[model samples]
Target: MTKILISIVGPTAIGKTALSIKLAQHFNTEIISADSRQFFKEMTVGTAVPSTEELNTTKHHFIQHISIKDNYSVGDFERDAISKIESIHKNNDIAIMVGGSGLYVKAVTKGLDHFPDVDKHIRTELNKRLINEGIETLQKQLKSLDFKAYQSIAIDNPQRIIRALEVCIGSGQPYSSFLTKTEKTRPFKVVTIGLSAVRSIIYDRINQRVDIMVNEGLIEEAKELLPNKHLNALNTVGYKELFNYFEGEWTLDFAISEIKKNTRRFAKRQLTWFKKDETIQWFDYTTDINNIINYLEKQS
Candidate 1:
C-alpha cells in the first residue's frame, strides 16, 4: 500500500483552511501548514491564522510553532515537515499538508536543491544598500542578474530581493540556478489540489479579509510585533504596511489600501508560482468540500 500526502494549495482568502480542515476531519489525520508567515507564534490575525475552533476541529502542526526572531527557511521546513509527515504516516496511511505558500509546499513535495550558505558580509552589505538605496535598487539589480527570478519574486520586496541577491553573489551564481531541475522521488504518493477563483472575486475577498483582520485587531497585532519589525517575518504583507504607518511614511488609510494592494499582488505571484506545477489538480473555489474528499479517497 502506498502512503499518501495530499497538498491543498491556493491563493489566500480562497478557503484553503476550511477545505483542509474538512479533509483532515474526514480522513482522521492531522494537517501541516505550509504557510511561511503564519509560522511565527506572534503573528495571528494579520497572518490570517486558522481560528481556535477550526484548529480544535482538526489537529494542525507547524502553525504558530516558530518565533519571528528565528531565521526559518525552506530547507528547514522541508526537513521538519518530512519528519513530521513520516511520523504521522506511521499511524495513518494518509496525511494532509495545506497552505498558500507554494515554495514551502514544493520544498517538501519535491526536494529542494541545497544552496550554499550565504556570506554574512555580502548579506550585511546588501542590507545596508537596501536600507540606504531602497527596494527599487535591489529590484533592478536582480532583474539585471536573474530576470526569471526577478519576474517571479515580488519586485517591491526589499528583503526577499536582498536575500536572493545575497545567495546569488555569495555563491557566484544566479539565485534561480539553485533550482537546477525538478527531480521527484518520494516513498509516499503525493497528490496536489489547487483552489482558484475569478480575479475580481479573489481581490474582493482579499480586501474584505483585510478589513476583517483590522476588526480582529491586526493593527494591534502589528503594533506588538513592531518592536521586532526588523525580523524577516515582519517583512510580510500586512505587517509591512502597518510598519509604514508607524513610521509616518503613510497614513492609516493609505497603509490599509497598500496592504490590500500588496496582498493582491502576492496572490498573483502565488498563482504564478503554483501554475508552474503540472501535478496540481485545480478546482473552482466553489467546489463542494465532499467532492474533494471523495476525489482524494478515490485516489488513495
Candidate 2:
C-alpha cells in the first residue's frame, strides 16, 4: 500500500480544524499541526487553537507542545514534523497535516536549505540595528538583495526581515538564492487539499472570528504572555495588538482594529504563497465532508 500524507491548508478561520478532524476520523489517523503560531503552549486562545472538545475528536501532534521562550525555527519544525509523520506512518498508512501557516507547510513538504548557522554576535547586532535604525532599513536591504522574497514576505514584519538578512550576511549569499527551485522529494506521497471560499466571505469570517476571539478571552491570553512579548511566538497578530494596547501605545479600539487588519493581510499573504503551488486541489468550504473524503479515497 502507498503511504499517504494529506495536507490541509488555507487562511485562518476558514474551517481548517473542523475539516481536518473529519478527515482524520475518516482516515483513522492523527493530525500534525503546521501552524507556526499554534505551537506555543502560552498562545492558546490568542492563537485560536482548537478547543478541548475539538481536540478530543481526534489526536493531534505539534499543537501547543512548546514554550514561547523556546528558540524554534522552520528547520526545527521540519526535522521534528518529519520524524512525527514517520512515527505516525509506522502504524497508520495515512497521516494528516493541517494548518494555515504557509511557510511551515512548505518547510515540511519541501525541505529547507541548510543555510549556514548565524552567529550570536551577528544576531545581537542585527537586533540592535532593528531597534535603533528601524526595520525599514533592513527591509530596504532585503529588497535590494532578494526582490522576490521581499515581494512575498510581510514587509511590516521586522523578524522576517531580520532573519532574511541574517541568512544573507551569514552565508554571503542572497537568501533567495537558497530557495532552490528544485523540489525536495518526500518518502511518502502527498495529497494537498485546500479549503477555499468566496474572498469576501473569507474576510468576513476572519473579522467575525477576531471579534469572537476577543470575546473568548484573547485579551486575557495576551495578558498572560505579555511579559514575554519579545518572544517570536508573541510577535503574532492577536498578541502583538494587545501588547501595544497594554503598553498604552494604542487604544483598545485601535488595537482590535489593527488585529483585524493584520489578520486579513496575513490571509492575503497565505493565499499568495499557497496559490503558487499548483499541486493543491481546492474545495469550497461549503462542500460536504463526504465529498472531500471520497476525493481522497479515490486518490488512495
Clashes of each: 0, 0
Candidate 2 local lDDT, 64-179, one digit each (tens): 99988888888889999999999999999999999987778988888776567778677788878876787788888889888887887777777788888888888888887777
* Stretches of model 2 off by over 4 angstroms after superposition: none
* RMSD (CA, Å), each prediction: 1.5, 1.4
Tens-digit lDDT track of model 1 for 1-300 = 689999999899999999988888888999999998889899899989999999899889999998988878888999999999999999999999999887789888988866789769998888788777877888988989888889777667676798789888888889988877676687799999999999999999999999999999999989888899876678789998999999899999999999999999989988988999888999999998888878887887
TM-score of 2: 0.96
Best-fitting candidate, scored by lDDT: 1
* lDDT comparing candidate 2 with the true structure: 0.87
User: Cα lDDT for residue 230, model 1?
Assistant: 71
